[model samples]
Target chain A: MSEAVEIPSGTLTVTRPIGVQFSWRKAIPWLLTGPLLLFMLAFYAVPVVAMLLRSVNDPTWTLAHFHALASDTVFFKVFSNTLYTAFTVTIGALLFGYPLALALVRTPRWAPVILIMILLPFWTSVLVRSYAWMVLMGRHGLINEALLALGTIERPFRILNTPLATQIAMIHILLPYMVLPIANALRQIDPSLPRASSGLGATPWGTFRQITLPLSMSGVAAGMLLVFVLALGFYITPAMLGGPREITLSMLIDLQVDQLNWAYAATLSAVLLATTLAIIGVFYRLPGVSNAFRMGAR
Target chain B: MRRFPSSKHFSRRTAMGLIGAGLAAPYVRPSYAQGAWPEQTSIPDILKGSGELRIATFGGTMQETQVKAYFEPFEKISGIKVRYFPGTSAPKVKAMVETGNVEWDVAQLSRGSIMNLQKQGEYFEKIDYSLIDDGVGKEFRFEYGIEMLVWAQVLAYRTDAFKGAVPKGWADFWDTAKFPGDRALLGTTGGGWPELEFALMAAGVPADKIYPIDIDKAFASYDKIKKSVVKWWDTGAIPIQLLTDREVSMTSVWNGRMAALQAAGVPADISWGQGLSKRDAWGIPKGAKNAANAMKFVAYSTMAIPQARVAWGIPYGSVNIKSNEFIPEARQAVLPSAPAIKSQLVNYDYDWWIENREAVIGRFNKWLLG
Candidate 1:
């Protein structure tokens, strides 16, 4: 209220107090974010910090869990496998999602319909969706049954409980996470830039390549980051859809926790958390990704 | 009828424990034929109490079966109120005891889990054998807990899979050329112990001498069918689902789950030969509020009539040796405890697993992914 003191008429330069204006501007954001910041600190940050501490502190202050991970071939295999799956799923999601997002933005008349189509599956529980994938991709599932009816194959194809199944289901589940951001960015683009480029006698493909694609790179970066980080921690999908050897770090953490090997489980969790942070760091280091994150925050 | 896959097993262990006083639960009529009510054994005076005895059960169908078998009747006959919670396991008990806020008077856990936790610290109250029924076998009794129910992990195959040949044992399950279809086995995905016993038997190791398991020989056996095995199932439902889908023509499944599937006309039959019997036990957490009532209820639940009631409602076998007489022979034939089937099953050594599980799992995971 003090900062809102009105200036005298026709004297626009008559001075509000500079200190009050600066203090209010600085304090508003903090005041607005206070509760959420406290909640995240209490529920998320503290537990995560405690969990990271458990990696070395539990039972005794020891580095055996990390030491074991150094030579653990299964750990290495699973870690690499996790990264491979995340990368594949991100690329897959981008391939499917970017086109859908483009279609969503380009077709204004059908925007709501396309949005609902994307949002419907997004709103469904991941478990239900994963199970739906199981029913679709199982040996005797709908796809195989249809394929058999069409005489496309002599025998039922194995699809479920494989890496292929894991990627497919993860992409399906994460498509919206990729699509919505890209669509938002695409919507934010001024329509005249492409129009002006085309007006200059530039070909449509040339205009799109030179004008539109570069503008949407931020959205693409944002979408890929979201999908990849989410994919890194996926548990139920791979467990339900991937093969026995498709063990991810999340599953390994779960396994160790069940065995009451809290220290090892904490170590695995810390590694996963660290890897996610590293990926985020890498994304930020990429050109335009930091801007994408800033635009995403808006 | 479904069991926990390994990832779910942890949450399943940290089960909710709540006490309800004088709460009336809906009566689920026993699915099996009923014997005389006011069960032949009388409730002792000490067993009749007006207070609540909270029990931690693995809810869903198991809870429903237990309610029909003992919880409802025990509440009615004894003046003691029976309050049932779901999803109890050894870890929950340990958590409760360590925190000094033991919520459950009693919990249902595996003998191995109870012993594993007991070895870590004093989490359970020592079993009072004098209050227990004589029908419970000597083998089922332990210092801290008593095994109350028995189920088996056995080979289950589609009746239509092999045309006329029956896959009688693990050897037949491993003989994919003869069986001629995909197979599923228990994997170490969900903190579930791998079925090393099955692998040993598949390698022609006698059921009697299967443990101290020859891990190398077992893996060698697993190698023969690794390519043919389509799924390494973690939960009880997966194998049944696989069989129903004909995705895998043969799989290792829990006997009770297979029974449910067969009842649903899935055409899957369990081969009890060389199966492994796993037990669920009742453990009273140390410093439980109603420890005395829990003891009395434990004793009451294992009596021949109550034990038979449980077997009648669900396909799980009763630990009470006399329970077989009360259950019809037809029902007994489907249970793991039946003499014909029991003779073939190798009793699982919980002690052996408790000692060697971590090392074995590390080796198993390395081998599996390799």
Candidate 2:
């Protein structure tokens, strides 16, 4: 059915469908997303809510686990350790990734080869990569043997089972996450802008600083957010390469779960989730990050 | 190039023989192609059942050994089919029991782990003592489970690193001045419980009096040697690797792991002195669908023949005392159960660990960070 409606503008009239056919177009997006939303609600949302509820709901509804965590020195220490490691690894990845991403996007002839080198190791399992790190960084490992042969130092330098090893391996593992996004952003930059700046008598460094760098801020922000969040929850790499004192919050959660301390583990997990959400919230508040997300939505 | 045989050359008699061999293959496929598996132990008719028995085990080469040792033959001897699920842990068992969805009929775990969950709630079935073979030692039998595999946590050291010197116990392990090398110990990072027993022994506490462990004192001892430990290994392989790489001159290693290290001719040796002997038990979850089959399988696997097969396959010791007769003397010399080695190992008290683990682990994390 069709109907004619008079507009507020004097005598203007419009014809419109007045039946079920008119509303169906508006429902298409929902219809497409309905199954996925339900699946996520059932598998992801429900479990997470249940897990959070478990922190206070198990054994007669109490927040003793969280309260205990507040006074627990180990919890504080491990939590701080996790944050510090994540921060350091993120910064390291950004420093290494930006140059690599620039190289990836700038060098047209070698882009595929460079991308392959970055992704080949990324395809390997984290566990296998961590073990490779262990082998390479060990006291008598290849690096040390070469150094010793060169007479760089009389004693083999201890690198494995140290915080340094953990940071190095984590940065290596997380490099691709930081690189791909920045490369995409860099490629999206209008080539004419930098060329125009140069055409206007601007120096190459000046053009890069004012035009190229500022435009790729969104990419840099996105990469940092990704690498930082992933590093925060790292378990295997740290456990394999870190020393005794390098215990992270994830390792602590694992220990509690193994001990059957469900409530306590739930509390620790909730805290980790909260911390991650808070960090992302802060990132979203930043201009560059929000702009990047808005662009991503488009 | 060589020409291949043609199907046209096949005769009627040859075809019939091929069919006969093909039909017999499933039955005659050797379960023990490497050597003779100890003769199959007899089982009661009641123990023979027709159903699937899902067994959960710690995966890897260990599961490979179990397949040859008992899984295949047990399925053949009893009417029950054994299905293996690897990556079994006590925590997983607890979660299954709690969810009322027990995936495994039986799981291989430590007595302490089973008892820890049992103490929390009803998680395990009361093991059928009558179904278990007589060859199993009385000590291995428990109310909720029966120990089928015995292993030890021992002090392993590089024989060449110490200039022909030997580390006898934890005290020597602690003495960096005497041994003069880096060390590694078991850490909780890898799902391993803290090595408090070793810590106490390092503090000069007698092995016999180690029960009801003094946690504060143990940490106090750990403080002294914390800097010396280059690594706090979680997996059994980590210690072996460290020792082989000379990353640590001495480390706490599993007895079973040491056999392979020795076989590889890594100049490393294990000292049984003050080592803690640990056992792995077959625990049936309370609501298992195939509990009957699980009971039967447990009984069959712990018998002399099957137990010997496991010992032959790996360096781990057998709970069935009678299995010793079937194992060669050369092999027995390295087993944790051999009298010479067994006498030196301190019997680990699972009950004590079960009661104190939560508190001790909390303290351990703090102490480790400190």
Instruction: Name every residue pair that clashes in candidate 1.
Output: B6-B190
**Residues B1-370 of candidate 2: C-alpha lDDT, one tens digit per residue:** 0011110121111222232232223232222235565768667797798979999887655677899889999998898999997667788888888889999999988899899999998999999888787888899999999999999999999999988989999999999999998999887764678889999998889989999899889999999999998778766767877887888999998786676667667788988899999999999998999998999899999988899888887778899888988988877888898889999999999999988988887787778887
- The CAPRI category of model 1 is acceptable
Worst 10 residues of 1 chain B by lDDT: B16-25
Strongest candidate by lDDT: 2
> What's the TM-score, to 2 decimals, of chain B in model 1?
0.90
Candidate with best TM-score: 2
* Fnat scores for every prediction: 0.44, 0.46
Chain A TM-score, each candidate: 0.91, 0.91
Candidate 2 per-residue lDDT, tens place, A141-182, comes to 988998999999899998998999999999999999899878
Q: How big an interface RMSD has model 2?
A: 18.9
- lDDT against true structure, model 1: 0.81
In candidate 2, position A74 carries an lDDT of 92
